[model samples]
Target: MKAQTANGFPSVQLVVVKNGRMIKNSAYGYISTVDDFGEPLMQKNKKPITKETLFDLASNTKMYTVNFALQKLISEEKISIYDKVQDFFPDFKDKKKALFKGKSDITVEDLLKHQAGFPAGAQYYVNKKITQKKKTDKRQNKEIVLELICNTPLIYSPRTEVLYSDIDYMLLGLIIEKVTGLPLDKYTEENLYKPLNLSSICYEPLKKGFTKEDITATEIRAVKRTKDEKFKDIKYMPVHGTVHDPEAYNAMDQVSGHAGLFANAESIAVLAQVMLNGGGYGNIKLFDSSVLNLFTSQGNFFSQAGLGWRRQGLNNSYAWAFSQLASADTIGHTGWTGTLTLIDPKEDLIIIIFTSAKNTPALFGRNLRGKYEGDFYLAKNYGAVTTLIYSAFKNYDNAMLDQMLIELAVGRNELINMIPEIYDNEGSRKDLTAIMESIKEQSKQSAILRKFLKSEKAAAILAEIQSRNSKKSLAKKQAEGQSK
Candidate 1:
């Protein structure tokens, strides 16, 4: 907490769980040091952060809203990951069919893996006023945003590459609503949160009766204007007890797939614990073990991502929130609003960090670096804390070390080049080689995995998976037709 405060972020809430029990739940720093207009305030104007302080979770909302929603639907057999985007919203079939042939090829799996080829995100909210002629038709905003996403040209062919995108998850949220006939928040609350007994997690906390005092303040809209021209002269206000992402706040009205949920550390820890327990907590089973495995396993994509969680791999940097010593199967995610959740299944550990760091001037071009340096500080703080936590567990066990060696040997030759930091002795080297030989003999995906390892192209492997799935689906349909 002190490191984060000294770096830039003012407030932080940390929760650590080991073996499904909370070991640490604490808060630090003030929620705000500046007022709504980015002006420095007196000490009396500041509010100290606490354990219960609600935080604008930003992209972390994806895990609870889009990811969990999809998992629930899949477990019910309502949808398959191989289902195409065109299958959900057929209106795209008639709209720009020739220009965007890739749209029809994009699958639910593509979006979940961020291999759908959508651009990162657009300031759709800023242009909404100019784009919409009828100002009073507020309900059409969602449709308009969807149209914008549909009209967007693909950056690459579907399943050809991985590009982390908010647009992908935005569409996933819409799919959840379309399939379940419930708002994203409603479905999650009734199905996931209620069962878990987590009452503190929800979308749009202010509308849900949370007071301004109960939630931490985020960025001032005015400060954001200096960085992006889209925000210039826009109605400025302090973000308190509300979503922070511009698209979620302005376009989606605090209900979006990519962002817009608010939560506290304790509630987030509960959710993480459920994930660590393989989709169950106590008597409640939100999903089957098979579903959890499918979602948390390493993807065939560029980033080693599962459905919505990022799996630890050799490519991951030390600045990442997960420990370097963590097993490859570890799954977790980070939020843009200074939040992190890491679940180490092998270690039976969960770590949650929530902060309102954007409330400080450092996030708005007022820091010593003279620009938004929050990302760097956020990574540093999260990485340092995670390292400290894992370090407490003593040396890495043989299983953990073996997994690291396999990962490094498979796709991370660069790490192998710097061997002293990883392999201390010739004995470890011989052990790694023997492990590799054993893996070569035992693994079923060895051939395919070797191809991907050699090529170092995650997109190619994932695309192959998609192609094979499509062929199987077509063959199944034909067989059914013949039987009938």
Candidate 2:
């Protein structure tokens, strides 16, 4: 792990895995809080965030739904990769008109790729009827979802352009329920987690390992006495311990197919390892490798999609685990609340980044204003390897520099030759320097790169050349400073 920060959140955890083993597992920031409205809320010594802390994994829940659907289909041999959404959910019939102005057809493949013509958000939270129900009454989430889709309009035909929609996955979840006799949660728990030995993952809050205060607080909304707010007190209503996303919380009764998955980084790692193992983690085969490959392979209809996972390097951004150093065969997804799990098949690696930053009222509503409807917002920064490499080289530590460069070379041999040039170019050099300065204090492994990244022994001949060039540039800068 490298570069963990609150960034105006309670806590965050970053992790790195290679060969199915954790190379770094680090935590940062406070876990509990004190004052809410000028008085103490949590009265104990603040517990620090750990890798085991259960985070609100907002949209990370999508992977589970996809996995469950795929697993069931594979089990029954009822569907193929080329299957269309129209095959099962014929309700998408206006699907022909769902395409963009000048596109082809929309496939199940397109929805998975996020190329479907649907907006990224919906206003499911503000529905007074849904919230007005007694807190003890079980939410009729399935019925609410039915009404939402029945009422909401489709933005465009499928496969038009890349527009993310929670409704798309929610529809898929409904499809899963249609195909399988059981509820989505029950099917997932019995089929997905039970088989994989994943005990900690869940959509609903559990009583054993958590409490009302254990969960992170997300937002603070202004309260109104009436619709006109003529008699309302001007104070923000405390939003803590509850699921922050209204549509997602409403979808699954706080346990939806698209969002509201709660799990620690460790449980996430186990799920990722299943993907790494080609649908089998240990002795158990969750699905055959062929089915796994089908899920991970991009099809002709969609430029970048596996069955449920998005292909890596789409839009120059990783759909998961930041951007990886591995091949495009990599697959993963990101949650709305700063949770991400990325799997790299080339290196057999899984990187899990989990944070409760979404629950912080400070950062929650800031970015959610302009276009997006979801009130939750999480920073998209990911995998710190590039920053680590740049830092090691800039600090002039020959050993640490050589080690990281060698690792990078081993990870991807082509990038090895470009190292010196990358360090020599003014723009690249400055970027590396800046990144190194920013992350150095927070990570001990990163600190090692600062001291020992120099060329060493017979293997580091390239590093020797790079070091000489760096030294010359440093001298020129120093001379220029003196002149100034």
Candidate 3:
């Protein structure tokens, strides 16, 4: 955690839960290393960060808010995943058949899977032309944004490809409101969080009694300007104690379904644990196990796509966000602000890593598309942390497992996922197919590979894997009443 803080982020909070208990919860660093104007601050002057400090959930809001509501609603028989977009909103009907032929056929499942064909984003907060009126009223502004989203043409046909978008969840928030006649925040609080006794997950925390010092700031010098050049003058500045997402702040006024939620580490751990428990915590039951199973289950058509969660598919996989040590059934989501939540039902484990990675020196345009060079933000480094966590579970050596899997006789898919040199090169993919077809007669491998494939050595690795997955251990743990 200290290394990650030194890398770029001012603060990082990590929470791990196992067997429905928070086994680890820790926070390090400060509230902000820089001021609201993006000016650097002296280390001693900065306020201390704590596990209680609220951090913006960013796109993680989609899973907890919109997806959580969808699960409950489906359990209540209020809505089905197969329902059409036109059923809820009149604007999604075939009004522009010539321009967008199949817009209306988009189902609730398509939106959840991010296959509804909407572009990754749209600037609903700002008008495109110079002569347009600037919206001030929050409610009226939301209406304008909704109309714009519905009128905008999709990038492709429904179920074409999984292009993650905020527009999908924005419409979902409206669907919740349409069904319950309550605001998104209010509905989730009453129906989901409050009942589960999870308080820290909420939108508009500044209005909900949280002070600026109580929440970790997402960005410094964060003046959100128009994406369209014509309205560059229209921008909001001095971001602090407010959402860093533009569409959430300027469009829905920090209460949208996509990215307006803020939460603390402990609260997030509880919510994740509830999912691990099959949607029940203590005496409360939010939904049945079937609803949880259905959402987390991998997509039939798109193997990588879960209903709303991210599925950890096998080799030649589309989703590799979770740890390689994570079981194939693991599901999770990440946020733009460098937040991650992973749930592995197979391990009865949940891991949360939240860092204020955006609270660094600002970057200008074109560079916005560039990657963060920090070690904490890189998948390779933090993914190693996840692997270490699994290693700590019963003191098993996963690094050895990974090394062996890479060195010897791995199947095609496992080899592809294990080696980036093979996975990233298009030609290497074709070469691998040929080599695997004639493995025994292929070119000579290193002596280490030959040694590891011996009967005793190979059997040791398999025994470790089988022991980690042993039903006898699971039965003993279950009999113990599941302690931390």
Error of 2 at 92 (Å): 5.4
Weakest 10 consecutive residues of candidate 2 by summed lDDT: 370-379
Residue 449, candidate 3: Cα error in Å is 25
- In order, what is each prediction's RMSD in angstroms? 18.6, 11.0, 14.1
Model 1, 47-120: lDDT tens digits are: 78778888888888888778887887888899888888888888654345444357777889989999887789
What would you estimate as the lDDT of candidate 2?
A: 0.57
Candidate with the larger lDDT of 2 and 3: 3
Off by over 4 Å in 3: 6-8, 128-139, 224-238, 316-320, 363-381, 397-484
Model 3 over residues 1-484: C-alpha lDDT tens digits? 5534543447778898887778899997778877655667887688988889998989899988898888889888999899887888888754545454577788888889888888889878765521154555334656777777778787787776778888999988888888888889999889888887777778999898889899887666555543432323544333567788888887786788888889987887777887888887898877778999999888756665688787777651423456677887788788887788888888999989887766754433342332332222332234655765776785765456445334433443344456644232322233233222223222244444445445573454445334544755787789886654
Error of 3 at 9 (Å): 2.9
Off by over 4 Å in 2: 1-9, 33-44, 78-107, 127-139, 207-209, 220-239, 299-304, 314-321, 361-380, 383-484
The lDDT for every candidate, in the order shown, is 0.71, 0.57, 0.71
Which candidate, 1 or 2, would have the higher lDDT against the true structure? 1
Error of 2 at 459 (Å): 36
Residue 323 error for model 2, in Å? Answer: 3.2
Clashing pairs in 1: none
Clashing pairs in 3: none
